[model samples]
Target: MVSVSASLAIAATLPARAEDPPPQLTGDWGGWRTELANRGIEFQIGYTEEAAGNASGGQHNYVRAAGQLVLGSTLDLQKLFGVSGATMQITLTNRNGRNLSDDAGLNTLQQVQEVYGRGNIWRLTQFWYEQKAFDGAVALKFGRVTLGEDFAAFSCNFQNLTFCGSTPGNLAGNYWFNWPLSQWGARLKVKSGQVYVQAGAYQVSPRNSDPDRGFYLGWEQTSGALLPVEFGWTPTVGGLPGKYTATLWYDTSHANDVLRNRQGLPLAVYGGDPRREQGRYGVSFQFQQQLTRPDVADPVRGLSAFLNITQTDRRTSQTDNQIAFGLFYTGWLDSRPRDVMAIAIGRTQVNGRYAENQALANFNARGFLQRPEAEYAIEAYYNLNLHSGLDIRPNIQFIRHPGGITNAKDVLVLGVKAIVNL
Candidate 1:
């Protein structure tokens, strides 16, 4: 019924005139018959490194790599193809994993640390088929596609925290391409003005040499009445393009990946651990405001401020309760074209603790988005328990008034943080 309603809405928008057909062999969908011609590429490169002066044993240092690439087309597919349209895309991230401190909680050499140790990455960001309704009110997308759940296009990123970068986004990840991101499956979505909805099924990721048969299913909704992200109401203003948005997403899976990419090459599983059935669902709220003028503005001509919070409930007993709050701002000085900078902060707390790994039983229990990067962080819990103290991972080595486990010397990040779109 909802699909039918969306189709009607889309049909209402498209021109009823008998439009010229689209190109053949290319599998074109819409706009192409009368108007079509668009293509482009995008890229990003970054570098970062950090070293603490002192620690429980020695100093700490962390290095990372991040990058992306985007190829877009303006040609409509419907006008070209009688059925589905075609668009091609690809994305990848090459990263190395490193351990913060050795068992002694002291300085560990980079050589001794293994960022994924002997691991590598290559994600096929996007490659799918799309079809637009004659009315332009509804569109159908198949193949590896982004489920644009809500503010995922804006929120769900935290370069500062290692945990915050889950494959990148999740409507399954934010960045164009990354790991533990969206699964390979079929998805359907609907959009009508300010309201949106979605349904999807995915082959879940697995662990180690063993694998599981896991899959996903879910739905979501969003409205402009209240911006849950920022704790208040804001509207995207014609004056500033700032507005508030509220979003809700839920997903459940009872399947897993057997291992293999489209080409039959071995690919990693999606998500599942102690529990045979993997379940993950969360809700988010956000608000954004762009402070700047179009014609004339400061070097920092445009400033966008946004915040989001999400909580998760999982069916797996090993899975920890999760909640995340993020605050961020981005812009450039004097509106310099290539000169841009951003600061983002997030806080997350899990049921199990690294320090309590002994009591918890499973220390290797994986962590996700805001996974307790640092104890006694700036936003979450206040006051430090000097007795039990707090723990700082490789990523959270820098933020704070130094109260957790040791002196300020132990938390300092300095180095190159980079990404490239190729």
Candidate 2:
């Protein structure tokens, strides 16, 4: 939902050559758009929709649709109030519709419709202010914000949840809130040359995920805080840009154990309160590079590859870790220079302790149950650039062992995604 905004922020942080303006459906609002931008105020509107159908292997074949609409604006404080190096952003989102993974009985660990969660309601997604100093080498931002907007973030080109957005959020979503979900937070970043380091802290609590709490900003139910640190390197390789990053994160909230009770006995068998762990932690790495380009001066047309790996606290996480890799080729067709073709594969591993707990539950019930080990996902899509500010992507997805259940039937899904910039 925040893909467009997140991309803008990411591009601003990295060094790049000046380029032409991004396309928009509305043509400069008859020159008023450019005038507002020149005056330090720019408005933004984006809409994204996803429709998916389970063609086979799910409990029942069905189709579902979900969409998000974002309304926002950016204020360049340097021009608006004569405060150099200051800027502010405010965004509100409206999300609605159903998730096929659950409604169609797929029960997949990763969603087939990536955009179909976090409640169907209105939300104040972002309200943050940032200041830069040292000739743009240092930046500090605070207020209501989402962690994945600036940490462990990745492109959302794929419709499958496994290969979209932040890996840590995919694994440890209980604490690591992703896009469309904002919490009180602050971040500090310092960049020197091609290397940069950043750290942040964000409020964590179950209240933040409540549908009715979309616009609630009180700190009454905050459990603790999430801390994350990242180091990154952006370099020009073979005259092409590449980014590599590593991050470590810890959540200062008590989480329940996956297998045992407070006295160290099997919770499934003993039937008591599960043990509460002190905290949760994880580490992740991201790599992306442009492999080749027919036209050296055309930065938009190239073959790019990305890899994301993340490991979370096994004691509290159902899925302990994941590894995903993908390749996207832009301008592969001479007739459709703006089109993109991409494919990705990913594996999500269930925590061993959680698997054991499931086994115990099955044994106690005297019923046969397949122990979950891992789930694998594969996807490919051809993005059709129908217009300068609109894109339609039709994709196919395959899932093996839905929900990591070893004996679960594999699933095949057909999907399409539409993106519009207004």
Candidate 3:
């Protein structure tokens, strides 16, 4: 799908370079002299597979593959009129999930059932348009954009084994929650000097195809020392840090209610028939800092740390109330060149008493989701600039449900991974 908005084209007339014109004077636009064209395209493909053996919980096997294509036409930096840039993107994915009653790779496979919407394939994950930023500073965007969907975690699933769920219980998460999140709205971006902000809203109609009004609001900013946002595309405890700065953000979501009947009786949850309305409301926060000691001219001398906290409550009888906490850090063994190491640890707790689908959320690197019950993860990754498309990562992940708690032998997962970024 392509969306085009035409406006005033850039002006094309220039005087001599004598001393410079007024500061507020807009630059020249048009003509072959200052025209800019992007005419660039890119594509990425990923595939992964995993299987378990032995007496742990039921053996599990999974496979996921995705591909993305992006197209962008060039634009003139000097032209000020009739939209200067245009971009379109497309994605597709297929994931197979199942738990085996016996050993998966050991011998013959027995009973294995698909989990949730496992067999379902998303032929098109995303389709959107991106304009040349209004200014080199504010990147105004709109359309059906993915929300805190947890994509980062989806990427590290197999290709790289070191990192656990960046968006654990999110839509693309492994254990419980699974769903590609989307928002229909407008987003504005502005930046000046070393400071910038991203804020946007999503509209939700009560029914699936109905026209209910819903909104998504988020704000993030960065300075010489701080980088903070209400909700990032990916969920993580690793906040952006600076030698001397602070970053912070807050956000909220309310789903549209299309379940009210004409007499105000509850009917269906998503359609616009005489229905009752309900929605999901939640907020999130993040903080980061770079610890420096005395006279250190370089940022390599300081350690950085951050924390994230979030909560959700839906006015439905199904599932409600969720909380999560995460901590992360980036500190070098010493102040020597680009030698850096990072660690991220996280814990997620859902209302264990509920029998609803609350335990289905997941957390992935792309964003934060509820994830499985009693889930904790610890990971370490080291950057290897010399080893092209490679990273050294070691990680430990624990997962379990109410059933796995009493057995003591619970669920334990450990692995080492290498990343090849093509």
- Which prediction has the highest lDDT against the true structure? 2
Task: Give the residue spans of candidate 2 off by over 4 A.
Answer: 6-22
Residues 1-422, candidate 1: write the lDDT tens digits.
Answer: 00001111111111111121211222233545223333222221221222222222234333333222222222334344434443333333233344344432432211112122213343333445555554544645555433332123332222333223221132222112222133345545455654445444444332110112111222222111111121223344665554444444444443222222344332322223322334444565555556554335432234455554444442321222223333322223333322223344434333233223222222234332222222222221111111111111232233332222223333344323221111
List model 3 lDDT by residue over 54-88, tens digit each: 23433444322222222222222234344465455
List, residue by residue over 280-380, the lDDT tens digit for candidate 2. Answer: 99999999888888876667677888889999988999889999988888888778777888899999999999999998898889876657899999999
For model 1, the superposed segments whose C-alpha errors exceed 4 Å read 1-86, 92-118, 134-136, 145-151, 155-158, 162-182, 207-235, 242-280, 292-300, 314-332, 335-338, 352-410, 419-422
How many clashing residue pairs are found in candidate 1?
A: 68
Ranking by TM-score: 2, 1, 3
Model 2 poorest 10 in a row by lDDT: 9-18
Which 10 successive residues of model 3 have the least lDDT summed?
6-15
Best by TM-score: 2
Which residues of candidate 3, in runs, are more than 4 Å off? 1-39, 42-122, 132-134, 149-185, 190-277, 290-303, 317-342, 352-386, 400-409
Task: List the candidates' TM-scores in order.
Answer: 0.51, 0.96, 0.49
